[model samples]
Target: MCDILVPLTANAQRIGTEEERKLLDQSIQLCQRLLIEVTLSEATKLVGRAEYEDALPGSIQALRFSLEIYGSGRSELIPCYILLAEANLGLSRFKQAEECLCNANWILIKTRDNDKKVKSILYRGFGRLYAAQGKREEALRQLANDVSPNAALTDTVC
Candidate 1:
């Protein structure tokens, strides 16, 4: 499953009331439980309402747990790296995000998933990192690549 951090962050931004905050906390806890013992759509659902920085540690832990359960050879690795990169980006940890993105890109390239949706994620991650570094051109390039109509080409590297 993919972790769409931007949407998650946007949803989390709606947390203003104490009741909403409590619900978010409960969702986070449920996500942790699901990640710890079982794979559940509930966990993915919870992710959409999670604050990135706040969810970073748990997301990383969830990925590790998934890797452990599914074995290192499984295909869950790419999304794990993507989640980590997005979390790091949310925390303004550009270097960590870049490193994670590098790993994610490597996985994607190796897997040869010709899916632009996955490629777009990698590009979006890079765009965030470049934007943080004040590299406007690089950021724009990455963002453009993310939304490019024909990102199926090999040169469409993030």
Candidate 2:
């Protein structure tokens, strides 16, 4: 319901990509629960596509913007963080990815929302993060927390 405008002077580019812009438009257009759900769904699907170099950034931006508006209490926040961690994992930005996952974990526990599913995803992100750091032992430990049990998988998260 509020218009957000930023000054664009001196070769300023959009903070996020076109796909992110569209998702934000869709979320804002309706300003209803269902529309937000749709936006979250679309963003998750985009993250699941795993084309990291392209789509993930936009999805990440869209999710972050959505969270900024919706607040961290929403269930969708966990997925957004997971998607962000995955994107960072793909790009080998281990520290940022770890921070994202840690935030998700903190929210989940703080809210007392016993959603094991989201926790599993968080563990997967941790697994990937550790793997990216070449810490196989830690990676395996976290990866074991995921839904699908695997000890021999070469790259559980990465």
lDDT of 2 by residue, 1-158 (tens): 11222221123444588998777656543454443455456656655776565645545555655565677766657777776777777778788788778877777767877666676777777877888899999888888867554422322232
Ten contiguous residues with the weakest lDDT in model 2: 1-10
> How do the residues 8-61 of candidate 1 rate in per-residue lDDT, one tens digit apiece?
334355456999888876665555446643332333334456556555665576
In model 2, residue pairs whose N, Cα or C atoms come closer than 3 Å (at least 3 residues apart or on different chains), thus clashing, are none
TM-scores for the candidates: 0.64, 0.63
- Candidate 1 wrongly placed segments (more than 4 Å): 1-50, 154-158
Task: Name the candidate that leads on TM-score.
Answer: 1
Q: Which portions of model 2 miss their true places by more than 4 Å?
A: 1-29, 32-46, 147-158
lDDT (CA) for every model shown? Answer: 0.67, 0.64
